[model samples]
Target: MIVIQAKLIFLNQQDKQIVLDLMRRWSSCMKFAYKRLLEGYDRKTLKRDLQGTFDLNSRYVDDAIMKARGVLESSRQLDNNPKKVIFGGRDLFGKLQKRHINGKEYQKLKTKWQERRKGNLYSRGDKSKKGNLNTRIEVKENGTFLRINVGERKYVYARIEAGYKKNKRREELLQEIAESNIPYSVELKLKNGNIYAYFAIEEEYPEIKITKEKGVIGIDINAHPGNISWTEVDEKGNLISYGNIPMPELASGSKDKKEYFRWQYAHEIVKIAKEKGKAIVIEKLDIKEKGKRGDFSGRKSRRIRHSFSYKSLLSKIKTLAKREGIEVIEVNPSYTSIIGMLKYAPQYMITKDVAAAYVIARRGLGLQEKIPDNYIKFLNALTVDELEELREHVKKTVRNKHIKKKHLREINKAMEFLQSLESKPGRVLEPLDGTSFSAYDFWRVLKVAVVTPLSPEKVKRDFSVLKELLIQGKWGGP
Candidate 1:
């Protein structure tokens, strides 16, 4: 899908003011709907209440309620002490110009909000507003022209430019509309004393081929401002290409500069995919949820999380790729960082971020993630007698006066299991008391031994590597 915006070229100033008046009304409706949402009104109740509050049609009120709710939800997710979502009086115009809601248009607006700042509902602008009701714009295809509804009983007719024909080499909105069998969505926006109509053009493309012959480009998004690590892999998941694309500091300094940099970076990535004839693979992330729950811990973590616009980056790349007829694949993000750090990074002699990207690409290609040889070699070299000695050492280290009886029992059971496993190498031990000793548990034992004189730093490191390997599905079940 590609979006093309054309200036709404009203015949006179009176025609423009007529639409601006409706925008003000839209602003009022959004404020009203926002207040209702703050009072915890659900959609059903809000829709009913909006009918009595706003002098607009039921559909207009419904869309306003929806937009207001979205604004509040977005603010809460991004802001630590989020301010109330309010569209002020300085600018009260938007692109939501149709009565019936358009899914792609709504998504586009939502993306804009997601990419916006703490207190603002929309991107900060002198002429633009947050709650532009889209119900006012309507588009219909005439013989060789297009008719657009600007305001109440007002219409603007536009002729199709000769250059924007179906056989044109470039992707034009009119050409896409002519070829598309489905309905098209239109957006009306007020910017710098001009009315602009944006048309979302969806085109049908063939399904992307997912086979061993073609490779995948995996991208690992980082919180470090503008750092995008990527790797290309073949059908069997062998590494083909890998590099980090460094962007300028995406800090909260200048919005326009940041936007320009992001645009350039996304195109650079898309260019690589287009040239290589590969599918783009990215980790499916929910940064808002991660940030809200305090999952991203540490001092600089919050700053990094807030600053890094992973969603926006992905959104731009996806949009650009669609324009070029390229495919994008999203994969699960579990342990890509940890597994990358422990296994792929050192083995491939690349940064952990790049390694993670490589792993993500392999996952997209439906291949298994692997641990490094050095770690595997260390695990294979471990003797059963040595495990017994290590267990006994761990027991001695933890034999403190303050140690609880329950913990002692757990240690005893863990040690006994190790001894049993010495003789019964392939035996699958039953989970003890509805709990299991993961590789982390083994690492903890080694750590305890290290605290005493029983074990050394090298032993702890070796066991840590084994722990990671075990958790990574190296030895079957943890």
Candidate 2:
């Protein structure tokens, strides 16, 4: 989809007033529909009620309901209270409530707030209606004009003042909309007392050039360290390239600036993928806001929630990939980090984040990771009593230190896994086959033996020494 923006110039004051009145009614209907939707009203009933109350046509009412539902859904996704949503600019609303400003400055703020709250109109496209019914653009030799249907036999024409000649893509799309029977949606907003139209048109997506059959570049996004790590792997799951994009400065910028940086980083990543001629494989993550109000959250949690936005960066990357005709594959994010930290990090002598990216790349190629024989030997060497003793030692260490509760739980889970392995016959346990002993089991045992006993700060930063411990079957640290 591509959006073309144009300024609308009205011929007379009467026509402008008519457009403003229509926008006011549309905003009212939208607010009503949103309130009713929150109160559990169905679409059919809301549509009927909106038309009756606002005296709008069926199409206008439907669009209003659609807009309202979109806003409600966005709020729900962000885990915000729908009742507390302020339709107008919330900052302006707060400023007015404080009553700090006076005279023209205060009046200007109030006017801007009112315009934002009530000066909007939306009309969906219909190919049957020659692109749009309520608001349609008509091309003429004189210039391009937007014909708005206000009521029964009522019409208003506004001239489009955009430089279509300067933009080849916009000019082509406009010509197509005028000549062909293509559908395009339009949204009009009153900004600073001028009408602006945003035209949304569907465009054909380019054919995918880079495909995963040859290779894939897997990405791992980290918020704590504020960096993105990626590993390129061939079809056989061998690493071809690896790198990291660090954006520590992104933590201290305005929202718009942060978004701009994200776009820049996304462009850089897609450029690399194009150069490598590989599809992009990213973890399908549903990252949520981490810090809670009035909770004793640490600096990492605060940084993750406030500074870095995983979804925003991921969205930018995916959007750029689509536009560039790059194939994108999403894999389950479960255990990618853990698998990387335990197996690939030490074995490949790489950072945990890069190891995770390597694991992601291999997983994207449908390859299964096998537990190292030394890790299995280390687990098999421990008896039930010895495993219980290790668990107790971890518990005591936790008491003396500040180990997270989740780590403690992981240690307990590993102890159970070891006890279950003891129940099997010596023959079945001798090889510790992949089918019987999974990667998850190995991860748990590593947590109990290596990760738990090591300093938390050291484990988070470096994993080079882990290779020696796992190879020598070292059960615990000094």
- Judge candidate 2 against the unseen true structure and give its global Cα lDDT, from 0 to 1: 0.79
TM-score of 1: 0.44
Clashing pairs in 1: 96-133, 96-134, 97-134, 97-135, 97-136, 97-137, 98-134, 98-135, 99-135
Clashes of each: 9, 0
User: What TM-score, computed on C-alpha atoms, does each candidate reach?
Assistant: 0.44, 0.57
When summed lDDT is taken over every stretch of 10 residues in candidate 2, the lowest stretch is 427-436
Cα lDDT tens digits for candidate 2, 168-202: 33543554455444678999998999989999989
For model 2, how big is the CA root-mean-square deviation?
A: 16.6
Reference-based lDDT, each prediction: 0.55, 0.79
What is every candidate's alpha-carbon RMSD to the true fold?
Answer: 19.5, 16.6
- Compute the lDDT of residue 442 as modeled in candidate 2: 64
What lDDT score is found at residue 74 in candidate 2?
A: 95
